[model samples]
Target chain A: MMETDWLLGFAGGLMIGGAAALYLLVNGRIMGASGILGGLLDGSDRAHWPERLSFLAGLIGVPLLLAPLWAPETHLTGNPAVIVAGGLLTGIGTRLANGCTSGHGVCGISRLAPRGIAATVFYILAGGVTVVLFRHVWGLI
Target chain B: MQRNLFALLAGGLFGAGLLVSGMVDTSKVQGWLDVFGAWDPTLAFVMGGAILPMAMAWAVARRRGVSLLGTPIPARAEPRLDHALILGSVMFGAGWGLAGLCPGPALAVLGFGGWGGGLFLLAMGLGMVAAPALRRRLDRLPA
Candidate 1:
């Protein structure tokens, strides 16, 4: 089961990388999910709104179309406070940092960019520590 | 027109990848982060797999200088380390640990994630809207 899961993950990663490649090669954009969405929201990338909207349409629409077949599950927490807090933090953090997992973790590190590498390390470390604290010590989540 | 079409295709591919890779599963994400517990290392494969093609893409991009659509490729980002990167990352990490959902998956899961997903998305949008003001305040503080 674990092996199967790992294989699936790898395959999916390949698809993600392929998508990034396509976006960069064809569109000349970095394919950062947060930046793509945040730009629209903050009015920073209004000039490229059509492209961003086109991208988001597929991002949301494909999954919506596939949901019946895939039955994707988030298994998110039931706690409203936790959910809200998590959402807010993720939003603010990603925007402030100007990237997220897709941007910094995948694209940034792949290109050997220092900022991407540093951001990935810090976030992963912080995530580990948070898990230890919240899940282990606090048992809050 | 070609740019929009390709962008849509890329987005579809990305969304599919998130679902297939089990990235939409909050438990899988939190479990991977749970290093001291029954940690799931599958995400490592995903990360490694993703980096492979992107690395090649970067190499090709360096030589080409422009996309196939004739748009200038974005320049490499500055290497400077600053307070915003570190601080925002820590906050993002904490939020990720708390909910096991990041930006991409958060949006991707909206179709089937039910009310919880909707609420999270709403809050996330609100936070994004408010971030600029907060960022201005943070910039004022001595680094």
Candidate 2:
């Protein structure tokens, strides 16, 4: 099961990279999920609303359509406070930095972009530290 | 019309990949982050696999200069590292550790993540709305 998990992850990752490649080659845009959604929410990229909306329609719509086939689960925490806090921080942080895992982690690192590499390092380090503190030490999560 | 169509196709593929990659699974994500505990190295494979084709795409992009669709390709981001990048990443990481859901997986899981997911999305949206104000305040501070 563990072996399969990694294999599946790799295959799926290839698909993700392929999607990003297609987006860049054909659409001429970075496939940054947060930036796409953020622009729509903040009305900053109004000129490209159609492109953003179309992308989101697929992002949300495909998963819903495929739910019957796979039934994807998040296993998110039941604590509303934790969930809300997590969401707010993710939202604010991604916006302030102008990127997230998809934007900085995948796209940026692939191109060896300095900013992307730096952001990935910090976030992963911070995430590791937070997990250690919250889960290991405090048992809060 | 073609641009929107392709965008939909790309988005659909990306969402499906997230589902297949187990990125939508909070436990897997948290497990990967939990380096102190029983760590899961699955995410590293995912990241590695994702980067391969993307690197190739960047190379192609460099040569082509414009997308096949004729739009100009975006230039590489400035290499300058700023405080916002560092600070925002730290906060994002903390949130990721807390909930195990980043932006892409957060939305991808909405189909079945129930009210908890909905609440998270709502709060995330509100945060995005308020981020600009916070950024302005941060900018006012000395570097």
Candidate 3:
């Protein structure tokens, strides 16, 4: 089961990378979810709204369709406070930093860009520490 | 029309990839992050897998300079180790650790994550909507 999960993960990653590559090679866009959504919201890049909207429509819409057939068992915390706090933090932080996992982790790192690499390292480390603090030290979350 | 179609295709593929990779599974994400607990290292494989093809694509892109559609590839960003990057990343990381959902997976899982996921998505939108002003304020701070 674990091995199957790993294989599926790797295959999925390839598809993600391929999608990003297609976005870049075909449309000349970065396939960053936060960047795409944030740009639309903040009015930073309105000129590209049509393409962005189209892209986002697929992002949100396709999953809705495929999930029922190939869905994995998943669960989010039921706590409203945690949900809200996590959402706000993710939104604000990604926008402020100008990237997220997709932007930095997959796209940026692939090109060996320094900012992408640095951001990935920073966020992963911070995330690891936070897990330690919340789950081990403070017992929060 | 072609540009929009490509965008849609790319987005659909990305979303499907995310769903297939187990990235949309909150438990898998949190479990991967739980280094001190029964840690799951599957996320690393996902990252590694995603990076390989993208790296190859980038190599090709560097030589070509422009996309096949004649659009200019985005230039590499100038590296900046400033406050916003660190502080914001720390905050984002903490939130990710807390909830095990980043921007991509958070949205991808919305169809299945129930009301909690919906609320998270809503709050995330609000936070993103509020970011430009917040960023402007943060910019005025001392370095």
Best by lDDT: 1
The residue-by-residue lDDT of candidate 3 on A27-117, one tens digit each, is 9888999999899998899999999999988888899999789865557888788889889988988988888999989999999888888
DockQ of each: 0.85, 0.86, 0.80
lDDT accuracy of residue A126 in candidate 1:
84
Residue-wise lDDT of candidate 3 within B28-132, one digit each (tens)?
888888889878888988899899989988988889999988999999987767777777787778788888889988777677768887888888888888888
Per-candidate RMSD, Å: 1.0, 1.0, 1.3
lDDT (10s digit) by residue, model 2, range B11-119: 9999899988989898898999998898999899999989999999999999999999999999988897787888898988888889999998888777777898888
CAPRI-style class, candidate 3: medium
Candidate 2 local Cα displacement, residue B16, angstroms: 0.2
Report the lDDT tens digits of candidate 1 across residue range B115-140.
Answer: 99888888888778888887888788
Give the C-alpha miss distance for residue B119 in model 2, angstroms.
1.2
Query: Each model's C-alpha lDDT?
Result: 0.90, 0.89, 0.86
- True lDDT of residue A111, candidate 3: 90
Off by over 4 Å in 1: none
